[model samples]
Target: MEQQRAAHSTEAVVGMVAQTFLRDRHQFVGELSQLMRTQLPVLDRDERLRELMEAGTTDNLMEILQFLQNEAGEDDVRAPERALAYARILAQRDVPAAALIRAYRVGQAGFLDTGMRYAIEFGGGGPVTTSAIVHIVNRTSVYIDRVCEQVGVAYEDERDRWSGNRSGLQRQWVTRLLDGTVTDTDAAEQYLRYPLSRGHLGIRAWTGPQLDPATAATVFDQLRTALTTVFGRAHATLVVPVDDHEIRMWLAWPAGTAVDSGAIARALTARGVPVRVAIGGYGTGLAGFRRTAAQAGRVRRLALLGGDHGARVLAHADVAAVALLAGDIEALREFVADQLGELAVDNERNLWLRETLRVFLAVNRSYAAAATRLAVHRNTVQYRVRQALDMIGPHADVPGGDLYPRLALQATELLGTAVLRPEPDRN
Candidate 1:
C-alpha cells in the first residue's frame, strides 16, 4: 500500500511538470521546430511545408502533453491528423522515410531534455525528481514509438500510392536516369518512349503560385507547343511533371543536330506564357541526358534564387559560373559585398555604374564597344567606368586586375537583387 502511494505521488508530480510545459507549449514547440530544421535541412526547403511541420509538431506535442497530464493509458494514444498529413507530404516530395523517422527521434530528444530540466526544477532535485524523470522517460519513449509506427505506416502507404500512378512512374524513371542508376538504355527507352541515343537538351519550366491550376496547365501546354514548333515535330520530346507548377522536359534530336537555344528562348518569349524556363546544353546519349538535366536543375535553382532579377528564359551556359556559386548563397553574397564594396548597393546610380563597368570590362576596356552596347557615348562609358572603379575602391586592383571584378559583375548581373545590398527603407 505504501509503495502504491509512492508510485501515485510520482505520477502526480509528472502530471504537474507536464502541465507546466503545456502552459508554455508555444515556446517548447518553437525550440523543437528549430532543432528539427537544424538537424534536418530538408525540413527548411519550403515555407508551406515548414508551416505544416510546425503544426504537426504542435499537435504531436499537445497529444503527448495531454497524455502525461491525464496519466492516460497506452490504449488512448494515437497519431494526430496533422502529423499523418505531414508524413504523406514528405513521401510525396520524395523525402526518404528515414528523414521522417529521424525527425521524431530529434523531437523526442528535445522533449526529453526539456522534460528532465523541468522535472528537476519542479521536484527540487530529490527522490521525487528521480522518480518523475524515470516516469517521463518511460512514457515518452513509448509515445514516440507508437507515433512513429503510425506515421511510418502513413508514409509508406502514400509512397506506394504515389509511385504506382503514371506521373510517379515517370518521375521514378527520370530520377533513375538523372542519378545514373539505369544501366540498361534499352529498358529505359522502352519505358519512357523517348530515344536515349539522340542529342538531348533538358528544360525546366515553372511558374509562380499566383497562377491557378487550369491556367498553369494551359501555359505548360503552350510551352510544349512552342518547343515542338521551334525544335521541329520530327524530334522526340518527353515532358514529365515535377509538381503542379513545374515540369522537366527533354528534347531529343537526330544525332549531330545543332541545338539553337536562342531560337528556343525566342519561341518561348513569343508565346508570352507566365512560365519561366531554364535550358541545359546539348548532350548526346545517356551521359549527355543526365548532364544536361543536371545543368538545367542547377540553372533552375539559380533562377529561383535570383528572384526579380532572373530572366524569363535562362540557359545554363550563360550563367554557368553563377550557377556554381548559387549553392552557398550566403558565401556568394558576402563575396559580392567584399568585391564590389559600395558599388554593390542596389540603388539606381550604383546599378548604372556597375552595368557600365561590366560592359566596359567585357569589351576588353574598349570605351567605344562599351558605349555601343550601352547605347551611350564613349565619354559616358569612360566616365562611368572611372566612377565604378572609385566606388569599388582597392578591391578592384587585385593581381589579376579585371578577373575578380569580372566575376563579381557577372554574379551581380545574373543574381540581381539577390546579391546586391537592399535599398534602405525610409519608412
Candidate 2:
C-alpha cells in the first residue's frame, strides 16, 4: 500500500510538471534564448542556433514527460536519438558543440526551475511533495547528461565525415593534376574554370599553427585580396584549401603580363601575421601549372623548416641554386668551405671582404664598378680583391678558376652555409 501510494504521488507530480511545461513552453524557450545571448554570443547571432535550441528544449521536456507518464524503460532511446539529430544539425551549420552543450545545460536549469515552481504552487510544501520534486529533478538531470554525451559523440563523428568528404574530393582532383594523369584537358579546364593555355603563377601560403575554420577562412580571404592586388583584380584565380593550415592558389594571367615578385613579397610581409608565402615563376600551358605548383610546394617546405625563417616570401628563381644544393647538405657544406675558404668564417671582417669580391666578380672583375656600387674608393676595392685572393688562393681569379667559388659564394649568401648560416630576411 505504501509503495502504491508513492507511485500515485509520483504520477500526479509528473502530470503537473507536464501541464506547467506545456503552458510555459514559449516562455521557457524565450528564457533559454535570453541565457544563450548572455553566455553564447555566437548562438545569439545565429538563426539556426535559435531554432535548434527551441526544438531541442521542447524535445527533452516532452521525452521526460512521456517517460514519467508511461513508466517507460530507461533505454527507450528517444532522448538520445533527438540529441543525435540536434548534433547533426549543429554540425551541418558549422556550430561548435560547446555552444550546443552549454545551451542544453542552461535549458536544463530552466526546465528544473519550471518543475520546482509547479511543485510549490500546485502541490504545496509537504514531505511527499518535496520527495517527488527531488525525484523529478534527479531524473531530468540524468536524462540531460545522457543527451549531452550522445550529442557530443554524434557531432564529432559528423564533423569529421563532412571535412573528410570535402578534402577528399579536392585532393583527388589536385593530386591527379599534379601527377600529370589528367588526360582530358578540356574537361579539367572546365571543372577548374581556369585556362589551360594561359600562364599560371603558383603560390602557397600557410601559417605555423592550425587555424579554426573561421580564422582560416579570414586568412585565405586576405591572401586572395593580396594576390588580386599584385596580379590583377580581374585575373582568374584558383584556390585550393589543402588543409586547416595551408592553402594553394594559382593566378592565371595573359602570357605577356609581368609579375612583380618583390611587390607581392612586400604585401605579404606587411600582412601583420606570421605567414610564409612561396611564389613559383610563371609557366605557360598545362605543364606550367603543375611545375609551378611543385616549385611553390618546395619553397613552402624550405620556409617551414626554418631555412627561410626571416623570409616572408620565397621565389623559386631566387633560391634555385640553394634548392638544388639543399638535397646534399654535406656536399654543399664542403663546397662552401672550399670556395670561401677562410672567408666563410662568418665574421664581420670576412663578410666584408667576401662581399667586395662577389661584387667585383659580378661586374666582370671591374674594381671601379664594384667601388662605385659599394660607395668606396677604387683603391679600397683593389685592396679587398687582393686580400680575398690571398685568403682563397689562385682560385679567386675571374673568368677561369673563379666560377665555382663565385657560384658557391653566391649560394652561401642566398642560402647561408651549414654552420652559422644566415637567416633569410626577405626573398
Candidate 3:
C-alpha cells in the first residue's frame, strides 16, 4: 500500500511538470523566440526573424520537448534523428554550428528557469513540493546537457558532409576544359552540360580568403543573381561550378550581343561580394571560349595588380594598354624609371609631382582640367607642370615622346611600381 501510494505521487509530479510546460506553450515559445533573437547575432537580421521564430513555436519545439521528456535522454533513438534533421536544416541555411549551440544554451537557461518556477508554484509552495522542484531542476539540467552534446555531434556530422561533394564532377570537368587538357570538345561539353559550339563570353570572379566558405557560397549566389539581372536568365547560362573561392562563368549570347562590360562589372561589384571580375568579349565555339577565358585571366591579373581603383572590376577592352606591355617585368620597371627621370624617385614631393603629371596627362595636358580634378588652383597646376617638365627633360620631348611618359604612368597605376630599388647590403 505504501509503495503504491509513493508511485502514484511520483507520477502525479511528473504529470504536473509536463502540464505546466504544455499549458503555457504560447508564452514559453514567445519568450524563447525573444531570447533567440537577442542571443544569436546571425538570427538578428530582419529577414531571418520569421525562421527564428518558427524554430521556437512550430513542430521543432515539440521535437525538442520530446527529447527533453524522454526517460532515456540522449539514448532515446529518436533524439539523434531529430537532432540530425534540425542540424541539416541549419547547415543548408548556412548557419554556423557555434551560433546554433549558443542559441541552444540560451534556450536551456530559459527553459529551466521558467519550468522550475512553474512546477514549484503549481505544487502550492509546501516543503515537499519545494524538494520535488529541486529534483525536477536537477533532472532537467542533466537532460539538457545530454541533448546538447548529441545535437552538437549531429551539427559537426552535417558540416563534414556538406564539405564532401560541394566541389565534385562539375568542377573537375570545368577545370579540365579551362586548362585545355581535354581535346574531345564534344565529350567534354556533354559532360559539362555546357554548349561549347555557341558564342561564349567568359568571366572569372573570386573573393578574398577572409570570407568563410558558407559565406562565400552566399556571395557566389549573389554574383549569379547580379549576372542574371544584367544579362537575362536565358543568356547568362553555364555557371560552371569552380569551388568555393572562385567562379568561372560563360554567357551563351549571340556574337553581336551588345555587352557593356562596364555595366556588367558594376552590377557584380554592387553585390558587395569582395569580388573582382574580368569580362571578355564574345567569341564563337570552343576556341572562342578558351581565347576569351585567357583574355579574362590577363584582365584579372591586372585587376589584382591595380589595387583599389574605385572597385576591383576590370574588362579586357579597358585593360588593353596594360595587356600589350605584359611581358618582361624588369624591362617595364626600367622603362618607368627612365621615362619619368628624376620624377620617379621615391619621395613625398616627387610622388606629388608624379600624381600631378599623371592627372595632367590623363586630362589631355589641360592645366585647368587637372586643377579642377585635383582641387588645386590653376597656377599651382601650371607651376607643377613646368617643374615636372624640367625634371622629365628631353626624355619625353620627341615625336611620340609623350607616349613613353604616359605609358610609364599607366604602368605605375596598373602594376603598382614606378621603380624597383636595389637590394640592401648584407653587412
The lDDT for every candidate, in the order shown, is: 0.83, 0.71, 0.66
Model 1 has a clash total of: 0
Judging by lDDT, tell me the better candidate of 1 and 2: 1
Residue 315 lDDT in model 3?
69
Q: Give the TM-score of candidate 1.
A: 0.67
* Clash pairs (backbone) in predicted model 1: none
Angstrom error at residue 140, model 2: 40
Runs with alpha carbons beyond 4 Å of true place in candidate 2: 1-168, 210-213, 270-273, 301-308, 363-383, 417-427
Across 1-427, the per-residue lDDT of candidate 3 in tens digits comes to 3212322243355456666677778777777877777778776543223343445344444654454455654455343443445555465445688877787778777877776665555555566456656766666566656656767787677656654663445656666777879878889777767789899888877765446667877877787788778777644367654434566778787767666667867786576656777777678888888888878767765665555453366667666676556555667778877887777665667767777888998888788899999999999988888888898897564455687798877676666642433333669
Alpha-carbon RMSD, candidate 2 = 18.3
Give the per-residue lDDT of model 1 (tens digit) for 113-191: 9888877766766788898899889889889999999999999998888788887898888898888788887998999
Q: Pick the candidate with the highest lDDT.
A: 1
Q: For residue 87, what is the lDDT in candidate 3?
A: 59
Residue 418 displacement (Å), model 1: 3.3
- Over all chains combined, what TM-score does candidate 2 have? 0.54
Q: Rank the candidates by TM-score, best first.
A: 1, 2, 3
Sort by lDDT, top down from the best: 1, 2, 3
- Go through the candidates in order and give the clash count of each: 0, 0, 0
* TM agreement with the true structure for every prediction: 0.67, 0.54, 0.54
